[model samples]
Target chain A: MERVTVILGERSYPITIEAGLFNDPASFLPLQSGDKALIVTNSTIAPLYLDTVVKSLEKLGVNVDSVALPDGEQYKTLSVMDTVFSRLLENNHGRDTTLIALGGGVIGDLTGFSAASYQRGVRFIQVPTTLLSQVDSSVGGKTAVNHPLGKNMIGAFYQPASVVIDLNCLKTLPKRELSSGLAEVIKYGIILDADLFDWLEDNIDALMSLDEKAMGYCIRRCCEIKASVVAADEHENGVRALLNLGHTFGHAIEAEMGYGNWLHGEAVAAGMVMAAETARLLGSFEQTDVERIKRLLVRANLPVHGPESMKPEAYIPHMLRDKKTLAGKLRLVLPTAIGQSEVKGGVAHDVVLSAIGCCLI
Target chain B: MERVTVILGERSYPITIEAGLFNDPASFLPLQSGDKALIVTNSTIAPLYLDTVVKSLEKLGVNVDSVALPDGEQYKTLSVMDTVFSRLLENNHGRDTTLIALGGGVIGDLTGFSAASYQRGVRFIQVPTTLLSQVDSSVGGKTAVNHPLGKNMIGAFYQPASVVIDLNCLKTLPKRELSSGLAEVIKYGIILDADLFDWLEDNIDALMSLDEKAMGYCIRRCCEIKASVVAADEHENGVRALLNLGHTFGHAIEAEMGYGNWLHGEAVAAGMVMAAETARLLGSFEQTDVERIKRLLVRANLPVHGPESMKPEAYIPHMLRDKKTLAGKLRLVLPTAIGQSEVKGGVAHDVVLSAIGCCLI
Candidate 1:
């Protein structure tokens, strides 16, 4: 087992990664002996892994119950959170109850927010089954549900008690979902880690092939970067904003395309290209770096350009409403080099328009 | 203007008490010039103070937008929070926006939770217009919306930038609302300060009559006690639980009776009496202290007994689900004496039954 600690003072928790940790309750959850745990998963994951996870907890003398939500990003809403609450309340789950999120990003986010809001907060553990969650969403404590107007627009920065990532669960992930997660993996490399960017370039084929050692290393490195970043800025007041490298444009694309139409990482992949293009126009990033980023996204089977249906005009309104915006000014995270990024706010409107135009297919 | 600081480290904010501060944007809001402010109120308060609050911000060159939700505690739900999101998105409110919760506890809670979850949170200010909010909810940062199954079952501990409590608004409050606020004021004295209890007894008439000095002192004292308790235990891990003196029983009453039916403070008044009775049966409290509590509540025009319709069985199910419960044990905050309380978990179920039977009219 490999472990990474997110140092958030007293709220800090561990992220454990192993191939079959999901079947090992002792290693998988941060639950106390005899604790009551409510495992929240989706229908898709429940049939496959819920019983094993449940039995593992029961073996540890922890009382266990389960609530399986319908799978899909479109179902990530307050209504679903209400459903989780109903299940817990119906079963008499109280403050002492532990909520274990046992699916991918959507489950992790929904459960985390439910834990954050239910009874003004409760203990929750994350068992992320998808690469998108294990490497990113499940690490930084950015839990939220989608709004009709935007993606991840309603949520909180509530940290988890622990995060368990079992790569064996990824064995069942469809190919498209696996590719979707690579977008975030590529993100950590592009926005902060130059060495990792080079590492990804060297091991792209290995990662795509599900090379255990390579996938484990990639997930750990991204989590380490995220842990350090989140520890320093849990509420996204400063440097933490850099982690949103492609989220501004990506959110616009997702919002425009309608949530679940374009998966989060797919939109982020295209969004990163637009950010690089914008940075290039600002004379900070080089053309070669932009091309290199495009090449990587292509190699990873990710989109390299924004959707043709979303024009610059359509992107501007959503960008303006992004959480990154300040005083009505756009705060875009742009690459200065392959491994470095900067958050530049108050960029000219025309510059953003041209950047969006540049990324159009 | 009178100010009490809730010392929550970096999240610390000031609670300012004065008459007509709501119209004084410069003193009431912690907003910078030209910041966008979203004033969230209910239909009741919109007709009373929305324009004045809006004009105050507009006077300060702050862009002002308003969303008036339907008035009443029942309206405090996720659907209303969704409405808040729609209004903010429609007006292009960004992270820099400051949300102003401008009504009673319902508006403050709904708006505060909205700010906590909007775009993963934006800055929010509390301008509580009712005595109930001004004394308690606005001081503590316990923001939430009610679920159909429970009161405040879904929420977050999101603090405001500042809380502006204009005592003049109490002039417009119905007599019942004034009495409701007095329940919390009486609670501060019961749980933490005996002297405050005596003072409330002495000034009950003055407070009921809306004497500015007495009411101001009452509100400030409650806030000070609340601020200290919240500062020591922001997440209610220990001493903070003491602050929920009558809340467990109160919440059960609220949920069972239906939210907004028995106003919060009314239910709390009755719940506190029940708690005193329970403590008495446990030999920790005297019958006289219970009568003293009952007398003060009666003097304040508050209920001193649980609803007759809610039998001990009905209370047990809801009480078992209270946030105060731990490991299936009912953690009841029973009064040890007139001036103090203790959270006693693992109390006898039959004892609780007798206490409820004792308190029922």
Candidate 2:
């Protein structure tokens, strides 16, 4: 097992990445034995992981309540949070009760949010089950429900008490979901670590085959990079924003396709391809590096094209309208190379529109 | 002006209590002068205070955006948060944007939740207009929207940059609101300050007429006590839970009353009366002190009774189901006297039933 802490001082919490951390989350939970806990998951995962997690927590003789919402990103809304709160209220959960998010990013985000909001927050453990979740969303303390206007429009940078990553769970992830997870895996490499990018390139086949050793390295390395960034800037007020290299464009794609339709990781994957092309056009990176990024995403079996339903004008307005944009200016996190990123502001509308034109509709 | 900092170390922010802090919130708002400021108000307080706040922020060269939702507790839900999020998206608000909540508790809670959730939190300032808001809700970092199953069911403890409690607004407050504010005023006396109880006892008549000196003293002292407790515990983990003296019962009443039927303060005032009587029965306090608390509530025109339409069983079921209770053990914050409180456990269900019996129609 590998342990890394996001040094948010008093709010700092640890992230444990290993093959079977979920079975013994209580061993590392930041609480005394006998404290109550609420494990939040969804239909798809609850049937598989609930008993294992409950039994693990039961070893501490702690009382645990389970909340299982409908599965899928479509269920990730304020309505779902309502159900979680109802379960917490019905079970008489209080200020001291710890919440365990025992599913994918949707479950982690919603449950973490419930923990943050439930009686104004309680200790929560993130037992992220999905590849997309384990690689990106679960590590950062950003928990939110999608708003009608935009995705993750309502949330908080609520740090998790601990994140228990059981990589074995990835064995059950669908192929498409695995592809989506690769998008974020590629993200860490593109925005910060060229060595890891080279590693992903070298071991692409092994990663695709779900080789335990190969997958473990990628997940641990991704979390390590994320942990360092989050510790330096817990809130994305500065360097944290760099983590959104393809996200601003990725979010625009998801929004245009109506979130959950394209899958968060798939959209982000295509978005990264577009970002690479944009950087190449702006002369920020060697055309060869952009080619490497595109090749990696293609090797991951992820989509490299966007939906044709939205035109360049549609994407221009949507991307520029992202919450990450500042003062009506587009703040695009463009990659200068596989290991470098720059937050370029005031990019001309024509430039962005032209970049959107590069998409394979 | 009196300034009290909720000494949360690095998370601490100032609470500036002055007659017209609203006129120039930018002075204390933690933002660059030209940064965008989104002021979220309600219909009731918008026509009166929004323009003043907007003009002040704009005068300081802060780009301003304002959105006024329906004014009432009924609007304090996920639906309303959507409206605020939409307005923020439409205005191209960013992580750097600051949200100014310029109304009572409902508006303050909704706006704070919006800011907390918007881009996973932007900066926000509280300009609480109602007495319930100024002294209690606004000071703490608690921010949330109510769920159909519960009050404040979904939210976060995202602290504001500053809280401006302008006493000048109290003069324009409705008589019912002034009385509602007193519920919280009485709460402080019961929980942490005997002097506040004596002050309320001595000046209930003066306070009813909105006496400037009496009201100012009540607001400042209540804020001071709350500020201290919150500084000690920002997330209601322990000491902060004590501040929910009548709130568990009050929240049940609010949820049962469909949220807006009874003013939050009125429900809280009645709930406090029940809690005091419960303490008297539990042998936690003297009958005389309980009576004094109830009588003071009555004199202030605060409701000391529950609605006849709601049944005792309806409330008890909801009360037992309160988010404040944990693992089916209700943690009621019973008042021992005007200045002390203890969070006791193992209170019998029969005991709570009896307390509800007193409030039964």
Candidate 3:
């Protein structure tokens, strides 16, 4: 097990990464007898893993309930979260009851948000089942439900009690979803860690093949990078915005593609390509570095390009509504290099448009 | 002007009480030039005060936008807040935008909640227009929108940047509303202020007559008392739950009566009368104190009792939904003496039922 604690003063908790972790709850999470626990997942993963997780929890004397939302990025709305809320209320779950988010980014984002708002907040554990969530969304403490007007417009920065990353769950995830998850794992490399990028370059084949050791190393390193960043900027007041390197453009793509029409990680992978292209145009990034990132994503079997359906203009309206925009100024996070990035406001409309066009070609 | 700060370590801010504070924004809340400002209010208060506040903000070069929601507590839903979110996105408001809640408790709670949720929170100023908000809701920084299933079932304890209680707005409030507001004023006296209770006893006639000076004193004092308690226990972990003296039963009444049917303060006033009776029966309070509280509420023209329509059984479910419940235990705030309290969980169900029945009678 690889361990990293998010140091949010007294509110901090640990993120434990262990292959086959479901067999031993005590090593990762503190359990109490008769504790009411809800594991939030989706239809896709429930048939594969919910029974095992529930049986394990039941063995620990925990009363377990599960709410499996429809599978997809489109389900990450306030409405879907209401399902989790209703389940909690129906069972008379209180502050002491723990919520376990046991799926990908969509489920983690929505469940973490539901836990954050249910009775004004409750303890939750992120037992992320997919790579995108285990590496990024589950670790950041940025929980939110997507608003009709903007993605993740309503939320709270409530940290989880702990994160339980069970590598065992990933064996059932679809190849497309696994690649979708890789886009975010690739993200940790692009904006924060050069060494992780080098490691991804070396182990791309094993990770793509779902080698347990390779996947475990990938999830642990990504979480470690995210944990360090989140510890410094829990609410994205400053340094955390760097984590949104591809998100601004990515959200625009997801919204334009009518959400769930595109997996979030797919949109993000394409958005990263756009970001690198924009950096190259701005003379901030080498053309070779941009090509390297595109190839790295391509090697992971992830889509390394934007949608042909979206005209650059179609994305402008959605980007304008992006949460990063302040008073009509769009904050674009651009990579200065593979290892680090910057959040700059009022990146010219034409620059963004041209970059969107660059990705279309 | 009177100023009291809810001193919650790094999260504290001043609550300024003055009649014409809004006219001169700089003295109370000076906004940085060009800062995006969202003015949240309802239609009823919009025509009355929005323009004046907008003009004041415009003069200072603040980029102010208004979200005028439908009036009445029935409209204080997540759907209503979605309208505010739409306008915020339309205007491209960001993390730095300051939200000014420009009406009463509904506006303040919704606005503070919107601020809490928008981009994971923005600064908010409470420009409370109603008596209930000025004295209690404005000071505590609890923010939420009603769930269809429950009142304030979803929310956060996000504090405001500043609170501006312009007592002048009360000049337009209806007689019933003014009476409803007195419910909270009566609450402070019952929970933790023997001196304030005595003052209410002495000035009930003047307060009933709506004496401006007396009203101002009462509002400011209640805020000071509330501010002190909130500062001590910002998230209702301990001392702050005492602030919910009548709220456990009051929430039950609000939820049972279908929310908005009994005004929140009115329900609380009636609930306090019942809580006083319970405390008396439990030997935690005396009979005279209960009578004194009821007489003061009645003298101020507030509802000192509950509706005969609700059965005792109907109230239990709503009480169970109260956010103060922990581990499925309904922890209630009961007054121990004239101005002291305690949180007792596991109060007998029959005890609560009998207390509810007594209030209805």
Candidate 4:
């Protein structure tokens, strides 16, 4: 078992990583004997893992209920979250009830925000099934449901009580979803951890093949990098903005393409390339570094560029609606190097457009 | 001007009380010259005060926008808040935008929750016009819109940057609305300030007549008590629950009667008497104290008993949905004396029934 602490003062909790942790209720979570645990999954993951999760919670004497939402990123919206709220109210779930987010990033984001708003707020634990969630979304407490105008435009910074990642769950992950997780795993390396970036370059095949040790190391390192950054700036007022390295451009792609049409990690993978291209043009990044990032994303089977159909100028409208926009200026996290990034606002419209242009084809 | 500070560490802000403060931008709010300030009021208040508030923000060189929602407690719902969200996105409001909630509790709650959820969260200022909001909702950071199933069932604990209370606004209040505010004023006296209770008794006639100084003191005192309680428990984990002294029973009344049918404060006024009666039967409160509370409520023109249409059994359904319920047990705040209260749970279901029966007129 591997454990990492997300230090958030008194609200801090541990993220435990181990195989088959989902089946052992006694050791996985800190739930009390009488706590009501609602496992929030999706139609897809529920059949695969719901019974095991429920039986585990029942073993710990937790009153268990389950609500499986319709699966997909397109279902991540306020309207969908309202259904979760309806389920909770119908079941007489109180403030003390513990909500367990039991699937991928979409489920985690929706469940966390639902817990944040239901009866004002409630305690929730993260049982992230997807690699994208276990490495990024589930650890940071950045929970939200997307609005039609923007991706993740409506949400809160509510943290989870605990995060339990069972590596065995990944064995069932579709090949496409596995690559989606690697996009974020690659993100941690490019933004803050140079060593992890190099490690990814060497162990790419092992991670893709679902080697147990390589997978565990990849998830743990990404969480550690995320935990450190989130601890310093929970509200994203400062260095936390660095975590959105590709998100501004990526969100534009997701919104313009319509959510769930393209996976979040796929959009982010292309967006990161656009950011690196922007940095290269601005004289902050070497052309070789940009090529290296593109090469790795291509090898991992992720998108290496924006949609060929979307003209560079088309992304501006959605980018304008991006949450990172400060004082009407489009603030973006552009990479200065493979192991470093900085938030740059007020970049000229043409410069942003040209960067997107560089990424097409 | 009088000021009370709600100390929540870095999130703390002042509650400023004065006459004609709305027009004095220099003396009000912490807004910057270039910040976009969105004034959110209801239709009822827009015709009366929206122009003045916009001009005030304009005087400080703030770029201003305004949204006027329909007035009424029934309008306080997630759908209504969604409209506010739409207005914000349509107007291209960004992270730096400051939302000013300018109306009664309904408008304040809707706007505050909108602020809390819009773009994840944004800074907001509270300009509570009615006494209910001025004293209670505005002082605490409790923000939410109601669900069809429950009052304040969906919300957040997002605090404001500042709370502005202009005594002049209350002069335009309806007589019934003024009485509704008085109910909460009397609540502060009963729960934590015996002196405020005596003061309400002595000045009931003057307050009913809308005496300026009397009304100012009443609102300020209530704010001070609320500020103190919220500072200790921003999330309502401990001492903060006491602030909901009669709210469980009151929420039941509000939810059952249809939210707009019975004003929140009016229901709370009657609910307070029910709580007193329960305490009296439990030997935690004296009969004389119950009479004192009821007499003061009546003198202030507030309801002193439950609606005859709602039988004891009718409340159980709604009470079960109350946010205060923990571990499936309905935790209620009951007065142990004239000026002190305690959280009491596990009372017999029949005991609760008879208590409601005692309050039915």
DockQ, per-model, please?
Answer: 0.78, 0.58, 0.63, 0.75
Expressed as tens digits, the lDDT of each residue in A1-361 for candidate 3 is: 7888888888888888887777775733666677888999999889887887887888888888888899887778777877777787777777777888888878888888778777788788888888778888888788888877788888888888898888877777788889888898898898989999999999999998889888878888888788888888777778888888888888988887787878888888988988888777888888899989989988988777688777888878888777677767778888999898888787888887888888875
lDDT of 4 by residue, B239-287 (tens): 8888887888899999898888989889999899888888888888999
> Which candidate number has the best TM-score?
4
Segments in model 1 whose C-alpha atoms lie over 4 Å from true places: none
Cα-based lDDT at residue A286, candidate 1 = 97
CA lDDT scores, all candidates in order: 0.88, 0.82, 0.82, 0.88
Show where candidate 3 strays beyond 4 Å. Answer: none
The candidate, 2 or 4, that scores higher on lDDT is 4
Tens-place lDDT digits, model 1, residues A1-361: 7889999888889999889886786865568577888999999999999988888888888989999999999999988889999998888888888899999999999999999888888889999999999899998788999888877888988889899888888889987888899999999999899999999999999988899999999999999999999998898998899999999999988888888889889999999999998999999999999999999999999998888777788888888878887767788999999888899988898988898888877
TM-score of candidate 4 relative to the true fold = 0.98
Worst 10 residues of 4 chain A by lDDT: A26-35
- Per-residue accuracy of model 1 over B1-361 as CA lDDT, tens digit each: 7789999888888988998886786865578677888889988889888888877888888888888889899999998899999898888887778899999999999999999998788899998988889888987789999888888888988899999888889999999999999999899889989999999889999999999998888888888989999999888888888877778788889999889899999989988988888899999999999999999999999998888788887888888888887878888888887678888989998998898788878
| C-alpha positional error of residue B248 in candidate 1 after TM-score superposition, expressed in Å | 2.3
Per-candidate alpha-carbon RMSD to the true structure: 1.8, 2.9, 1.8, 1.4
TM-score, every prediction: 0.96, 0.92, 0.97, 0.98
By TM-score, the better pick of 3 and 4 is 4
lDDT of 2 by residue, B38-71 (tens): 8889888888877887777778878988888988
